[model samples]
Target chain A: MITLFGVGCLVFLVVCALVVARTRDLLAATVVFAAYSLVMALVWQQLQSPDVAITEAALGAGITSLLFLLAIGRTRRTEDEEG
Target chain B: MRHVPALLLLLMVAYVLFLTMAEAPAFGVVDVPSRNLVVDRYLDPDPEETGVPNAVARIIFDYRAHDTLGEATVLFVAVGAAAAVLVGRPGPFATRPVTGTDDPILRTVARLVIPFVQVYAVYVITHGHVSPGGGFAGGTILGGSFVLYLFVFGPGRAARKLSPARGEMVEGLTALWYILVGLGGLLLGASFLANAAAGFPLGVPGKLLSGGAIWLIGLGIGLKVAATVANLFLHLAGES
Candidate 1:
């Protein structure tokens, strides 16, 4: 049962990662990346490492996304043109 | 066609991970090589020797202190680089500030919740020997609280409490404090970061002030992380 649940989560995580990579909208990608980190935190919790899980949740998901948003707010929201 | 190599790389990574996972010992097996004598040493004799009940804290701040010092230094350097780059060049962000939304709901909620978060952060750092939290976690939460304050009260008001220059000094000092604590061991006739062997009085096990240099190390790390995160965000947001 746990394996099934974990597999389901992994599948969802892969989809989220793909979306983040493929999407051109910077803000949308940032939001999806945050969701990916949340799933990663859950995976760490399932692996029984609460320390890493907490760090992943707080820094990886919360603070990192916030930082990206701050940077985005300062800079451009759209992707630049390729030469 | 464009993603062919990337897809192949991903497959290779998955294969490597599977191979690694296969090498791990079966779950619930205590006799595995991964569960070596070092684990036993920490579980049995280390607590008695160090008087730190939390094995993670002891491992990080006592047994492997040089690594912790390195980690703190890395954080310090990262913050310095961030501030230098962000603050040195004042771009469009400086002209028209992006943050500080005067939403009363955010202000009211942040005003109510920030104190508890900051207090809890302190508790986590102080009680690291008895709980799951440590300097890193506590410091991040503390930093988060500061960010909340910036969102609620705006950078103009927040600067009154802690200016960016002062934050740089604090973070640099905390990094130095870690080195000084390690050097204290040298003063005690032992190597750097020598916990019990360096004559540090390990108070009663599981006590708040116990764990000798571990708590002190945690304190330095906690403060350093807090200062770094606070300054990094402020600088990135063009407030500093």
Candidate 2:
């Protein structure tokens, strides 16, 4: 039997991932993805791999988000009319 | 078009996650062969073999110092590449003058915290053999402090203290130092990064100076990674 808390966390991670996929603004999507990584790190910690949790928090939450933000800064802003 | 591949990738990831969960080991059980090996032999080795208080540091810096050297080199390369891309333009300086109003509250907080942040960074690096964190974690924190400086003081002021060229030099030298230590083992007829095999003394376990060549390797990696990440952000902020 799945606990309510586990179900809630899984749903939240799914929602965050979907939002990251659908967001039009690249920077906003990067932030959302960072949040998703944080949730995943939490799940990893709950699974009792604190070392994996730390790596996820560092690489996923920190460096991956920074890389995305930098890439967004380098590129020209997407035009609203281009869709 | 582009979204097709991304969507497919996400689906594949979800499928993999489902499969992993389905086949996952029971909670608290050791399943993987490597995990079993590590738990059986090394987690709390006999005092004769692992002469250290912190087993993580002993594993990372003493037994696996070559991997640490390689990790530092990776960061050094990243710094070099970022500098080359961001600072290599040859036209007359294109930097914009700083014109934003400085927030006194932020500045005051930064002034109060920056010293402690730096001190903690050094302490974390030095005390790797006795604690939860080692060079990489401490180095990331040090890099984060510089990022905080960029956020509060603006890129212009931060750049004066940490120019891209200087950061590149520090990254290069420290990376060389890390690699040279590993190479020293080779010269002594042991495999690279063989701390005890290279004749360094693994001092009393819990002391700051113990763990043979681990502390030296940690210091080199800490300096190199901190400079590399700082340079990465500085270049991205266009201060290089």
Candidate 3:
């Protein structure tokens, strides 16, 4: 049962990663990347490794996403050059 | 054309990972190699030998202290590099206003929440021997609180309490403190980072002061992590 859930999560995350890679809007990508990190944290939690799960949730999801969001906030939202 | 090798490399890496996972002990297995050796000793650790109850914290702070020290050093260097890279910019470092920050909701929320978060960080660091919390987790939380403070209160107020300079100093001192604790072991004719044998008192188990050098090391690590991460934020976020 847990294996099924784990497989489902991995599949979802791979798709999320691909979407983030393909997305042109840098801000949207950053937000999606944060969500990806959060789900990854959830996977760790499901594995019963609370130590690793907490670290991932705090650092990966919380701080990393915020940093990316802040950086994107200060820069262009999209990759397109406006002439 | 160029994508083929990258694709092939990805497949190769995936195969290696798959094989490794396949060989791993089945989840929830009680008879795994990991649960075989040294697990019993840690489970029933002699209080006279070591006061710490939690095997996770005890192992890291006692058996594998050098690794933790190395990790702390790495974090220090990483934060230092980030600060140097970000703060090297003259305009961002200088002209950014250091004060007069007031977003009403953020300010109120941060003011209400930061103290509790900081208290929890301290609790996690100190209670490591009895719980899932430890130096790394606690320190991260401590640093995170400061980051939250920076976002709401701005650099000026945060700097007043813990500037990048102060952070560097704390990290340096804590790193040195870990070394000093290691040296204490040598002083007692024991190996570096020696726990009870280093003459550190092993009080009765479950007490706040019971873990001897483990708790001390955790304290040092917690302070260093907090400082390093907060300093990292100050540097990266316009250093106001």
How large an RMSD does model 3 have? 3.6
Using alpha carbons, what is the TM-score of model 2? 0.78
Q: TM-score of each candidate? A: 0.88, 0.78, 0.84
Candidate 2 residue lDDT tens string, B34-73 = 4765566556754346456667777777666667666666
CAPRI tier of model 2: acceptable
The best-first sequence of candidates by TM-score reads 1, 3, 2
Docking class of 1: medium
Enumerate residue pairs that collide in model 3: none
* Selected candidate, larger TM-score, 1 vs 3: 1
Clashing residue pairs in all predictions, respectively, total 0, 0, 0
Question: For each of the candidates, what fraction of the native contacts does it recover?
Answer: 0.46, 0.03, 0.26
At residue B84, what lDDT does model 2 achieve?
A: 73
DockQ of each: 0.53, 0.24, 0.36
lDDT of each: 0.83, 0.73, 0.81
Q: Give the TM-score of candidate 3.
A: 0.84
